[model samples]
Target: MAVGAIGVVFGDIGTSPLYALRDTFAGHHPLPLDQLHVYGIISLMFWSMMIIVTLKYVSVIMRADNKGEGGSLALLALINQHTTGNRWGKGIILLGVFATALFYGDSMITPAVSVMGAIEGVAVYQPEMHPLIVPMVVTILIGLFLIQSRGTEKVATFFGPIMLFYFATIAVLGLVSIAQMPQVISALSPHHAVEMFLADPFRGFLAMGAAVLAVTGAEALYADMGHFGRSPIRMSWLAFVLPALVLNYLGQASLLMRNPAALESPFYFLAPDWFQWPLLIIASLAAVIASQAVISGAFSVTQQAIQLGFIPRMTIKHTSTAAGQIYIPVINFALMIAVILLVLVFQRSSNLTAAYGIAVTGAMLIDNFLLAVVLFKLWHWKKPLAIGLLTMFFLIDGGYLGANLTKIPDGGWVPLLMGIAIFTLLTTWSRGRALMRQGMAEGSIPLEVFTKSAHSSATRVPGTAVFMASTVAGVPSALLHNIKHNKVLHQRVVILTVHIEDVPYVEPAERSTVKDFGNGFYRLTLRFGFLEETDVPAALRTVTMCGEAFDMMKTSFFLSRQTLIPSDKPGMALWREKLFAWMLRNAASAMEFFRLPTNRVVELGSQLKI
Candidate 1:
């Protein structure tokens, strides 16, 4: 299981009762409690959970795995693999990529909102704590990022029990309130939701954006499925988590109807004075886990992005083998900066809520779109069954998205700005890669004659040498530079290329392909699934099974690095080219991506621009 998977995947949606009820009442279109309004809000939350989380994700979409991995991109890859020639593949791919881009935006905002909201509980008990909120949040955020280098193994152990207690606390509180006001149980009816929407269509629609916050991190459960497996997650949701969530929401609403003055923080108001401070600390810690989950997910996604050619390869370190824990320093710090800025700019948790739901709901919609393709095209499910399931999910997701758009003028600009920035980066990197590949193709030299002549003339040295190549056929520019600088050749020379297949998982038999290029020279290519972690050194050891003995200590690895230069070329826009170049310059080296030993690695620089 992922170290903090349960907390990260379930916490955001789990904690929705904290503010969802209050927000719905006092949100963009504040609704008064009629029996119908209460029923409507409850009904919306129920079906939102049903369609967005359960039916669409847990039942249907989760089945569309890329070699037992599920996510927007992974699902996209699965669809593309099965239906490459279909007309809809391109559209589905774009939707998946777009969803992936939006997910980055959500990753940034979730930390800010979750942590800030939990810390904001201080204001309820002691208004004096308000002034220190931002700094405290910033400090905590910094501390969280700092500890990432060390990994989350110890911290993750507490996630399940703590979250279980948190859920139980809310459920008990709600049950108590329900005993007082039995009418709250009636809110589960569908009529209440429809009546509320029809009676005050505009206001009900506007409340959806805020309402959607209740289900913000639902996608994480699906994304992190590979870590915990489908059965455990499914069982957790059905048996304990879902009931607790619904009960707490109902209890909060029941309490509100009796005491509208409790509108400020119904979550805290539910607790007694003795329990408040402890609850605050627990909630705060839970929020940190929630934030950490998304941050780590961003790292995993970034690795996938690089593998699929949407981004450049970076140094990815696997922090733990048992838990599939990973840490990417560049991504960690980047997320830290963005999250802190979000907290500073938004100032309050309530304000951040506006920006939180859009990206998540948008991504969920894309997931449904891709899942439809999986069900009908890939899984070969009955078309009517797939259509029926997908339609329900789309309508619910559409409502949530429609609701969130109203928040744009409010504090919603935060996610929109982040989304645009991320989308630009993703598209630029993807396009830049295509152009670079084209340029490399034009410059490439055929290997047949060069290999024949070079192999016969070159002298053999003492040990093995591994050269990292960008392509299978052409000699890497780095190899040429290395040859010029050091005329001496190793006794055994291997040209190695690491390729990230667009699919999610690569079969073991297809992991690598090797050819004897005559003399002591050999050429090898390593392939990885988008969902599988890449450890080049580990892969090299396994190549021996394929009839290649890779002696690590004896192998000296060489890689090519490009310093991007902008030219008046008919390619990408000048600004994007510069941006791609900037990103490339700062990216981690191939030695790290391939897990080559530091002492034996060599880098060669070449100038290229798109």
Candidate 2:
């Protein structure tokens, strides 16, 4: 899992040295290979990794799991769990959801930038191939996405060894150059970083944002921790990945110092021309792997988003019976199209690099903010340690965010546009859901009254009937209609509300809150961590522990499908309100989300105007 997880989490950051060194030198500042610039860049990279990756994430943020899962949703769930139904919790939930929305933008751009960057080497080696780059890339990208339905288990097996070899090759190439100029190692000093900034304060600061591209996928490390476990990721980074990355970077700097003309793709130039083509092939393969990692990540994140209710559930296919083997066709195709378009428009990795870091860095900044809340509020860490760690991470992340801002005029507008579009969609969907629920509640009977009236008025049926409600306190229209239509109440009634808490993972203790409503009727509120996937049928199986055996054949699950009544409601804009309604109509049935038996599932429709 660590090997597989590494290819997913660290690929973006891992491949950064490919362009980071070149971008920093020829970036907005265009600094010379003076000791200060070299040392400053090295120092900044090291400490950025230390604070952002090592301290904040590995040491602190990973500790705040929602059950055993960790990610934006997981952290949000933790805050939600502790804060309960409070305004602040709502705010944190929005922040977390927004962060998640931004990740979609990152996911789209990562493949575009990485693949473009690698393929551009073709131009460097054979300029004639430049004309074919976009087409070639498009073809490969389309093929990659098309195969997603088939699953990546077999393809992923080679990812570890290939990435390991790539890392080793770069490290060896870098070390060879560094051995010739051992003084390059001294650039690790913080004073050099300070001096470079002081000498060209504005440009240096702007460059930090582009430099941030080097660590774009840092958040994925934490998001993926559940897949690989903290120990494996931590050990891999400390023992192997980090050291190799540093050595290669230092070697690149050493070569840059000796041959100032090597600024054109220092990564490839570090190797002999004879090896350049082979290096390009190796690098391109690595880039493709990096892109695949993010693509798969997008699928996983989308699944969580749908389950959590911030987004409408779309058709989700389980490509494998294995846990987390989800394939969301809508999201996969959407990303594939965007990435192909990006490659055509940006044309080169250097151009797309400007658009890359902003979304990722913005997401990373949000991760730090949420981590702070987790450390102080959830983990109950002492004030000093929490504050210190938060401050360190914020400064490092802030520096990169500030730098990336400079690229806005030079194509950085891509991610910004992408982020705004995604954020709006997320906010609109979440707000719209709330308003729709409010409208539905206005027509719902209070649970207490419904229980009293339906007990005797409704005819008795032979088996169990489970009604899925948005809220536990309100009676679902499905239940009301079921009784009205058949005039039959089951021998047992279960009002099950699946609450997608705004957290990453849910602990076992917080799994279900059960209340016996008397007369063989039960209210079950199942709480799931954002990290844990929700299965309705599986949750039903646990009702026995609450004093009821779940008989599948005798059980019927009911869900209310809310239809939209577009009106002059003083809620959302007319256009957005209509869009929300359309989305609701298209979302996958609640029966699927809850893992309910398809044959026993029942859906009722009710019109809502919000």
Candidate 3:
């Protein structure tokens, strides 16, 4: 598992050395290649990793997992489990949701920057090939996305060893360079970082916009915790990944100190002339693995959002028997388009660097708020200690964020704009769904009342009918529509409500809650964790309470397909209502979403004003 964590969880942060040092010295916000500036930047990078990734995430944030799951949505769901009815719940939810929103921007930018940064090594070794860099990056990214549907299981088997080799190579390159200039090791001390910033406050602050790149994928540690577990990820970071990255950064600085012109591409220069091409190959592969991790993380986050009601149900395809190896076509293609555009527009890795750090820094700052709630309200840490830790975090993250904001006009606006648009879409869907549910529930009849009165009022059919509802209370629009149109009820009627719990998995023993409503009517509620996929037929097969076991051929599934009518109801703004209506129309049908048999399902359409 620790080896796997090296392959997957550390890919993003591990690959940071490719561009983090290069960009700091010669990026859009270029710092001098002198000893003072180089030492200062390396020192800051080391400290940022320690504080943000090690302290906040590894030591503290990973402990806030939701039933062994981690990520913004999982953490949000965990918070909701405890703080659902609190007055401040809504605000915290918005912050958590926006953190997810920022992640989309990060996802798009990561592929563009990481891939381009690695491929740029070719241009560094052979300056004549520079003109082909963007095209090469675009081609590589498109291939990466195209291969996503096939699943990463086979390829991922090689990832651990490949990453291990890459890390070892870079560490060796750094060690060789440091041997020539042993004094470069002195930069590891935090005092150099303080002294440099004190000597040139404004330039040092601006340089942070680029230096923050060193920890671009720090959040992946928390987000990918579920895949490898906390201990494996922690050990991978502390023992293997951290030492390699720090050594590589110090080596880059060491090279710069010996020859300032190495600033053009210190990472490649660290390698001997004969080893440069192999280093480039290893670095490019590492970049692909890093981008793959981010893309997969996007899929996972989108899945969580859909289950949590922040996203509309899209067509999700499982690429492997493993529950986690699933694919969403919409997310895949959407990310592909965004990444290709980023590469085309930004053209160079250095230019893309301007757009990179803002989203990451912004998300980290928001995590501080989420962490605050966990400490005070959930974990109940001592006041002074928690406050002191939080205060330090806020200051460090606030500085990074403020510095990154200065790059907005250059290219940082890209992620900020993307984050805002995605945030609006997520919140709109959630709010709109709530309003539509309320509108649908306006005149709902109780299940007990309907079942008691229903038997005598309608003719009895032979096979069972399962009417699905989002909630357990009252008669569903589908059930009401089915009886109203057909004027008949099945011999055995079941109103099934699926409740998505806040945790990641629910035990099979606890999934079904059956209540006999009398007169051949049974109210069934199936509980699922937020991370679990739904399969109505499969869950139903295990139930023996509906007089007899469910046979697929003898059962018919009924679904309510709401045709949202945008009106001047006191719900949402007109534009949002229309947006929700469009989303409803486009979302995957219940039969597809729940893995129900297509031939055995019936959809009843009803128009509702929200």
Index of the highest-lDDT prediction? 3
Return whichever of 2 and 3 wins on lDDT.
3
Off by over 4 Å in 2: 27-29, 33-36, 85-87, 381-385, 455-461, 490-492, 501-527, 545-554, 567-569
Question: lDDT scores for all predictions?
Answer: 0.79, 0.80, 0.90
lDDT of 2: 0.80
Q: In model 1, state the lDDT of residue 538.
A: 86
Query: Tens digits of per-residue lDDT for model 1 on 1-610?
Result: 3323456578778767766777778766677766667778888888788777887778767776666787777777677777787788777877888898898889898888888888889998898879999999999999999999898878788887788777788888889888889888888887888998899888788877777877778898888887777887888887778898888888877888888778888888878778899889877877887888888889888877778877777767777775458888888988889999889988988787878878888888788778777777777888787788778788888878887877888767767777777778878888887787777667766666656666656666888888888778787777667666776677777888888786767788899888876767778899987767777888888886323477778788887777777667749778888888887777777776666789989777888755
Error of 1 at 128 (Å): 3.9
* Model 3 lDDT tens row, 328-446: 99999999999999999889888888999899999999999999999999999999999999999999999999999999999999999999999999999999889877877788998
lDDT per residue as tens, model 2, 1-610: 6676666667888888888878888765566667677778888887777777777777777777665677887667667667876667777777787788789888898888777777777877787888988887788788888898999877887888888888888889989999999988888877878888889787678768766766677788888776778887887777777888889889888988899888877888888878889998888888888888888888888878776677887777787767667788889989988998888887877777888888888888888778767777777889987787778778878878887877889888888888788877777888898897788888877787788888999878888888888887788889888888889899888888878666665677778888887777788899875545677777667655446578889888888887777677559888788777777778777777667788998888876678
Give the lowest summed-lDDT range of ten residues in model 2: 539-548
If both were scored by TM-score, which would come out higher, candidate 1 or candidate 3? 3
TM-score of each: 0.93, 0.91, 0.99
Off by over 4 Å in 1: 1-6, 85-87, 457-462, 481-491, 502-509, 531-533, 545-548, 566-568
Better of 1 and 2 by lDDT: 2
